[model samples]
Structures are given as C-alpha cells and as structure tokens.
Target: MPTPSEFFDPSFIAILKLFLAMLLGGIIGTERAVFARQAAGTRTFGLVAMGACLFIVTGNYVDVAYLGVLSFDPLRVAAAIIMGIGFLGGGLIIFRGDSLHGVTTAAGLWIVAGIGMAVGFGLYLIAIFATFLTLLMFTGMWFVEDRFKHWFEEVKGDSR
Candidate 1:
C-alpha cells in the first residue's frame, strides 16, 4: 500500500484543471465586469466554471472508485450541469420593447460552463483556445458593432 501523500498526489490533476477553469472564467468575467451592462461579474463567472469542474471531477472520482461494478456516469452530471447553467443564463437576459440586452452575458455564462467542462475532461488546449476566441469575440466584436452602428446611423441620417 502507498503512503497517504502518494495516494492523494494523483488527485492534483483535478485541482489543476479546476484552477484553469477558474482562471479562464475570471478572464472572461473581468471583461464583462468592467462594463456596467453585465449582470454576472468576475466572481459569478469564476464560481460557475469552478462549480462545473467540481461536479465533473466528483462524478469521475465516483466512476473510477466503483469501476465496472457500479454505473456512475460523468456525462450525466455534465448534462445536468449544462441544463442548470442554461437556466441561470436565462436569468441574465432582459427583453425590452425594441431591443434585448444581456444576451452576450447570458451567452458568456453558457460558454464558460463549456470551458469548465473541457478543463475537467483534461482538454487544456481546447479550453485555452476557446478562452482566447471568446475574449476576442467579446472585445474585438464590440468595436466592430459600435462602428457598424455609427455607420448605419450616418447612412440613415443622409437618407432622411
């Protein structure tokens, strides 16, 4: 039998994964948190990602401990997490008369959950790439959107 330290050392991978999830979530949330329109902030995003990772890690632990004798599915836990995150995302959206706001924030919540899952599954590269792309979308796309809005308004004014 191995010592306690040796037995517990293997679990460090899960901790690393969860930390990555938290870091990615914090990056995304930082961008949103700076804006006044966002409903979810850094802490919320961090928690969501970390929470998702925790569930996946826990399910995996149970599955491994039981081996083939018991059927503990990590995918089921993932599915449930997705569903719950969806509900939470819905809460971020606000529908107004002519426009809908908070859609981006809601989408962020959903994608952050996905990032967490990827990390939990040991897909570090995938999670990092997704985080980079998400940040680009959130930041770069804002400028593009603003420019297009300005151009559209100018065109509309000239037409009138």
Candidate 2:
C-alpha cells in the first residue's frame, strides 16, 4: 500500500479533483436523465465537467514562470472555457413556435462547467455545495413548478 503522503501528492490530488468534478457533474446529470429525460444526460454532463476541470488543471501546471514568460493569466483559460460552454449551451437551446426548449438543460450545463472549474481550483466545499444546490433546484423546483401548474390549471377550469 502507498504511504499516506502519496495521497497528498500534488499529482494524486489533481487526479482526485478531476474525479470529484466528474462525480458531481454526474449527480446533476443523473437527475436530468432519469427525471427530466434530457438528451444531454449523465455522460454528457460528466464529460463536460471533466473537460473543464482538465483545462483548468492543465493551465495551473503550465509552468510559464520556468519558461521565462511573464504575465500568464490563468483566468484567460477560464474565460475560454466559459465561452466554449456558452457555445455548447447555445446549441442546446431551441426555439419552436411560441416557446423555447432546452433552456434548463443548457443552464444546467453552464452551472456544471462552473462546478468543475470550482473543483479544479481546489474549492471542494463550494463545489459540493453548488452541486447540492443544483440538484435541489433541479428536483425541488421541478416539484414546485409542477404543483403551481396544476393549481393554475385548476383555477382556469373553475373560471371556465
């Protein structure tokens, strides 16, 4: 068995962060798949989160200082990730007739990217809490919205 220090090694920690990001994203994706029945389900969300985390982790380890390069802003990579996610999210959205669809799924993806970024930056608590809140919004808000729609339908029926 490896020593305890091995677990705390930077490389090990980085891998751990990636797995955590994937797991968290998978949790959100599970809800979308099983409950919402979205096309972009567990694999899609997990891959997105893992990809974002990979970019962040790679940026962190680029070693520009050793290459005698100055003014390397890591946030640039983050901004690029955001822009990329925006493109992907945009693709998910569809406008048909008088209504739009996939907005929630796109938003879920956007937030999952943020969650991965957070995990990649070593903010475990924030990432986990954000994941919790995302799930809550997904499942809980769905329940609330369903109830509200039912109630509205009932009121409309009464009026008719």
Question: Cα lDDT of all candidates, in order?
Answer: 0.88, 0.90
Model 2 clash pairs are none
lDDT of candidate 2 at residue 40, scale 0 to 100: 92
Local accuracy of candidate 2 as per-residue lDDT tens digits, 1-160 = 8954365877788798899999999999999999999999999999889888988888887854345575567789899999999999999999999999999999999999999999888888999999999999999999999999999999999998
Q: Give candidate 1's error at residue 55 in angstroms.
A: 1.1
How many clashing residue pairs, candidate 2?
Answer: 0
Minimum summed lDDT over a 10-residue window in model 1 is located at 1-10
Tens-digit lDDT track of model 1 for 1-160: 7644366664887888789999999889988998644769898998898888888888888898899899787889999999999999989888899899888998999999999988888777998899999889999988999999999999999999
User: In candidate 2, how many Å is residue 154 off?
Assistant: 3.4
- Distance (Å) between predicted and true CA of 2, model 1? 20
Per-residue error for 135 in candidate 1, Å, reads 0.7
